[model samples]
Target: MQLISLCSGSLAALGAVLFAYGNGLSKWGGLAVLLLGTAVLLLSLSLQRRQEKEVTRLHRQIMDFLAGKNKTPKFSVNDDLFAVLENSVVELESRLLLERENTRKSSKRNADFITDVSHQLKTPLAALKLYCEMDQARNLGAHSQKQLALIERMEHLIYSLLRLEKLRADVYELQFAKHDLSRLLEQVWEELKVLYPEKKFTIIGTAELRCDAYWLHEAVKNVIKNACEHTTAAGHIQVLLETSETVVTLSIEDDGGGIAETELPKLFQRFYRTAQTKASGGAGIGLAITKTIVEKHHGTIAAENTAHGLRIVMCFPILDGVLAAG
Candidate 1:
């Protein structure tokens, strides 16, 4: 194409010179040459326009394929220059298909493992619980009571671990809906009253929020349980629920011995127990599960040490179109 353009330009320039200086026959021949040059120039431009259109179409096709708007890609140009790019697209598609297959297999394996573990543990835990109850009925000494407590703790730890794993892996489907914060707090407080009959609990304020009610209740219960576990009989626990235009916040405060400043950040991490917590038979996964539950609902959970004790706060975004609290 470049060669054609150069030859045509040269012929047009030569024709101009001949038309300027030559006789009648030479002048007519020069005019024909100039006309031919102009025709060839127009033809070259037409071909260039055709190539540009092809390129634009190919770009759009590739983009659509990458964006998942198209499953199959068709390329019209068989030019050698495009072969490498075409081959790359085909290879990428093949690799993605393989990755999807591998992911499906991995997910199936994890599901099977979780089911098997849960089933195997259930039978033993049931038997242990029965035996613990029988020993208590027989009026066995404090050693028997301690053994039963240990067994119960083991059961709790196993269940918590299973739940934590499923939540962290996104295997559990959460059911999210609007739930009244005041009522949910009342339910959690009732459970806490039974769990820690000695400790005092107070609810300070209320707000309405949207979340998976069951899961959010469990998350709050764990936070309150942690507070009760740490707080002394002389201390009290307080819960404050507040909402703004964009967010809802739940704060759980305890008057127990506060955690060390350095250990505050690690409190919500999986299997992380402070020395004080470890001494008190903490499994270290309750707060971790609480954190996961809060975050799964597009929220944040944090903890800090207060003058009286440890304080934990959870914040969740208000759903769109919901009225903010006054």
Candidate 2:
């Protein structure tokens, strides 16, 4: 545009000079006319150049911000030639960015939900699959027997996944029931013995804890399962259930090497698994479910590296109805 304007003015100046000389007009008049045209051309060229540079800079800044690279304060354009376009582009970009962030949050939520649904459907499917794959014949063939055992293992995993899924869906899906907390621990330990015969899980301390019985059982079992998965054969896992006037503490620990300090904060996040357990087949929902269940029961859970290993500390609030005066 600027070049066009300059070229047109030069041509007009030449025409004016020729006209002045041919028609015998004053030469200074033609010169003044040419100078005025030249000044107008320069002004237009300068404005166009400024606009082009501003547009280029704005494009670069937007790109940088989108890629999370440049954080050089938001481009403020209260007034300018591209002000309207800038405002429009910025508003559009903000909406797009907000949408992207919302998309990420929604995706995570869907992933968690799908995981929960898949888990809920696993148990019955596992039981059915196991029953179908088993050899019912009086004399079972070796191959069929091996297949049956494999089916059983897979079925168990499916059930575990389902339970873990339910835990994630709602930690307190199972309502509280009046029972001896000690008894529930014993039952959970007995179940663990069958699941992990090679490990030694010792339960210590006494006193009844008030909690949602089934979900608490699931939380305890999830912790035990975590320990079993990470520990070697005959590895030591301990469970301590302690009760005071106001709070109940349940601690589970293992001799296995603790989690990385960086990953510690995310231990309770759904589908987040540690490097050590990645090789081992696990859905990675156990601890997350445990945390959910603990929270559902109005309890607090935390993790820390102990002298020998990792310790999970759980605290539950005791609920006692207010006393009624006579």
Candidate 3:
């Protein structure tokens, strides 16, 4: 750069000398030299700005890195322009390692809590399910049947709560692997069909979707089961799928009574239930679990009401894979 600047100055001075002698076009020559000097200055400044920006960008990325410490894996940015980025990344990673240690301790506590609760609940729940299946169950009337059904619902609630708490402690347990989405959805549908024998379900797309097979399966199953629990016996549930180069969307719609409009926003929060059916079996964590699993895969889930009933929509990115759109 210095050599270029010196060369430009020499040309300008030389142009001045030529004009002083008797070249009539010396004025144009000098102006051309001045423009060349300006260009050199601009180039040097632009390079400086780019180098500075690379440093600032790395600094800003660190803030996001720290913010995502618990939720995302650690990352590093190594650039030749900002050699300090490597050191900073290493230090930040050491700090993240400490953070992970703290998280592990907290996770152990939560796991212990869940384990105790499950152990305590398991004994009675097992006895209840056993008693309900006994000869005494044969003699029970409709009112008694309702009581037994409530017990079964409570049993499911206990199991789901335990499952969520365990997963919540170290959510990374949700595995990701290549699997056919169509087959998984079929399995969830078959299970829900038998569970809700009176309802009808239809799958609407022909293309195969690839994603975290088991987690997606659980998410879809929970959503469908939640819909089935709310739906009437004669209602219909439709699974409409849309795919593109980048994403796959699965919309599960039911024809039961829709939820209150005001309650829609809180649907995915743990332990929150709609007033219309608080007596239903769920502890309100089903949707929350579904949301967590989807988000871990960098996907999204949303709930809406159709003219007839409720619908849950899930979208998964087609990561590192390609498929035909439908």
Candidate 4:
């Protein structure tokens, strides 16, 4: 455009000179300058249009590639003006492909490591468990009992880690079914009673929801176990279930020494143990596994300190056509 303007201005100057001189050469000289300037202007406009089209084409190619229409972009620069841009796009594509390959390899390595460790520890854990059972049969003394307890704790830790690893790697399948949420709670409560044999558990309400019965059972058991461990023998733990049009919520509240305010956010993180829980022989993986299971079922789990204790709530969204509780 600037070149075109400059040429037009030069033509005007030549015309002015022609009028001033009025020589015989003025007429032909002015006409020649005007024609040359017009040609330059037209050529410049044509080049600008072609440049615009090239840019539009390049942008479309990028969009197409991003939208997954093309795995490999077919781009060629016929003009020198776009040579730098074309090179940059090609370089960026190469780097992105390399990064994706690296990520895939890293993920595979992680999964392999978890699988190998789980397999390698199983035989030894089984043998230890068998030894503990035999020692219990023999009516072992206090030291033997302590050793058995330690062995049991170690086995629990190993199994919990394996479950967490499988969950992280998406290796386990969830069997979703229409299960009675109330019944599941009752079963878990019964199991907890048998496990603790000293704590009290209360059922407040009942509601039915669709979920993976076994996995959800595990999740709720973890929460109940947590409550039992945190509460005193006289303290009460309550299970409450509520259902709405779009969601089903199950809450476990206990009148125990509640968690510290700062620990609420970190409660669901794997291997995160508060100072108070360290002596409780908890590996800190139960809540993490529970969170992962809840999330896999398209639910959210959170913890809050109540006026007297702690409450853990898990809510799952109800899809269309699912049964609603009255």
Candidate 5:
């Protein structure tokens, strides 16, 4: 617009100068040209102002529509370009909303199905366990004992699946509070000692943070238990706590040989097991549940190979006043 105005003004000035001083040009003709140039300049300025106003209004409408202040945008019928853009945006928004609704419904249905099936299986599983106990009382052979152990393993797997599903579906309620981190790890270690009596476990350092004690306990226990399983009978598992100004890190390192680099990334995937874990009777659900729990607390978990073995690091952000007071 400015360029057009400058060009028109320059033409008008040239014509006026010719009318005043040029001998070859007719005075009347130069005057007529000057008038025409001035008229063109004025007309271009008017059109430029109108176009700018229209563009401003269009920009505001598009912003409002995107911000959810307007469901439908209005535009002048003569604005072919802007009108086309508005229509395209509306169509894209509709498709996105529809897809979002479908995803929500599908997730709800899947969660409900899992919950129903898990509940239904519980009754039959309980009966099977009862029958196995009765057979044991009758002094069943080694075969019957193996069958009972399999049933117990199945029960454990079913419960782990239910927990993982609930976490994924965002249905699990976490109770967060400031708790002593050392005490929590000690509590978990106490219960695990009976199961891995030969494996040595140790907790070092102390700190406090806001977290869901029960779920965090489960998460820490799973990591330590996993470490115990992968290590030798006399292997040492260390739990170390370190806190900085903004982050709290809990690291669990085991003397067991670290997993392959390729398999580390998939360690937390549900039902994903490497040959070593599969041989240990791992259902591969524990670490998955632990990952979900840590995420729920707005934390992160990662596994890396250490010189001695594998290290699982869980880091949590220290919100204002949460760790400072502790």
Candidate 6:
């Protein structure tokens, strides 16, 4: 429309100039031409502004639709392209919402199944443990002793599985508070020390963060215990704490030969054990539980092979309010 208006105005100006020239009115013709050009420029500017406003309106509508702020967008009947785009966006949003709902239902079903199975097994497992205890009390033979040990291990595995599923399903409540990280690490080390007295454990620094002390202890203990299992007797396991304005990082490094590079990504997966770890009798739920706990605290955990051995790092964000309080 703007282009046609400009072309028509140019032709009119040309005709007026020729008429004025023939009638000896060149000055009037010049003024008429200037007026025509000005009108055409104003019209074009008006058309451009209207087009821009239409585009801005369409963009906002699309954004609102996608954000679920608006369920139905007002479509422009005059603009076929804009209408088509709006329909496409609405379709995409519908598909995304459906997929999300399906995923949520599936996760809930899986969590419920795990919870039910864990509950069912607990009763029989308790009975089995009791029976084994009774046999041991009667001075059962070595074979019975081994069976009792296996049963205990199985009980532990079942408990760990339930805990992992609860954490993953967000049913586990974490009590968050500002706690001294150094003291927490010390507490974990104290318990681990009794289990693996041959391994050397050290805490090198201090920090304080808002976290669930109990769950965080569980996470840290699991990592350190895994480190102990992988390391040689008398190997050094160092826990380093470092804090910055934005993050607090806790690193556990051990002199155990690091995991294979190919298996690094699978470390946090439930029941995923490398050949070496499988031989060590790990059910592989520890790291998975640790990852869930860290994520629940809005933190990140990663494992990497260091020059000396393996380093598992957990980094927690320092909230603005916490920084201010500090």
Backbone clashes under 3 angstroms, per model: 0, 1, 0, 0, 0, 0
Model with the higher lDDT, candidate 4 or 6: 6
| lDDT string, candidate 1, 1-326, tens digits | 67777887788888877777888999888888888887887787787787677578667765565445656644435666555676667667667757755865775576567667977998988898788788889887657788788888878887887888777666777766688898998899987787788888888888888788898999999888888878777569999989899899999999987988899889989899988788888989988999988987778999988889889999998853221110
TM-score: which is higher, 1 or 3?
3
Candidate number that wins on TM-score, 1 or 5 = 5
Best by TM-score: 6
Please report, in order, the local distance difference test score of every candidate based on alpha carbons.
0.79, 0.71, 0.72, 0.78, 0.83, 0.81
lDDT tens digits, residue span 1-326, model 3:
45665675666566556556645567677666656666766676676677678768766655545444333434445556355655667576677768777976896788778779888988987787677667356876556566677778777877787777666566445444566666787899887777788788788884455556776788888888877877777778889888898887889898877898889889999888897558674578889888877776667888888789888888887754221110
Deviation (Å) of 278 in candidate 5: 1.0
Error of 6 at 72 (Å): 19
User: Which ten residues in a row are the worst by lDDT in model 6?
Assistant: 317-326
Model 6, C-alpha of 256: deviation from truth (Å):
0.9
Point out where model 1 deviates above 4 Å. Answer: 1-115, 124-145, 321-326
lDDT tens string, model 6, 1-326? 66866685785677567656655566666667657766776777787787778679877765565445765444445556657766776677677668756865776677788889988988988898788788888876556678888888888888888888767665666666889999999999888888888899889989999888999999998999999999999999999999999899999999988989998899999999987789998888999999988887778999999988889999999763332211
Per-residue CA lDDT of model 5 for 1-326, tens digit only, reads 78988888988997898799866647777787789889989999998887787678766765564444655444345556656765666676667557655865775676788889989998998998888888888987646678889989988998888888877666766766889999999899899999888888888898898988999999999999999989998999999999999889999999998999999999999899977899988999999999988887778999999989999999998763332211
Estimate the Cα RMSD of every predicted model relative to the unseen true structure: 11.8, 19.9, 7.6, 12.7, 10.5, 9.1
- Using lDDT as the measure, the top candidate is 5
Error of 5 at 215 (Å): 0.6
Say which prediction, candidate 5 or candidate 6, comes out ahead on lDDT: 5
Q: What is the lDDT of residue 289 in candidate 4?
A: 94
Sort by lDDT, best first.
5, 6, 1, 4, 3, 2
Per-residue lDDT of model 2, residues 150-243, tens digit only: 6666655555555555444442234454557678878998887887888887778875665567777888888877888788888899888788
The local lDDT score (0 to 100) that residue 258 gets in candidate 4 is 90
- How does model 5 fare in lDDT? 0.83
lDDT (Cα, 0-100) at 23 in candidate 3: 51
Candidates 2 and 5: which is better by TM-score?
A: 5
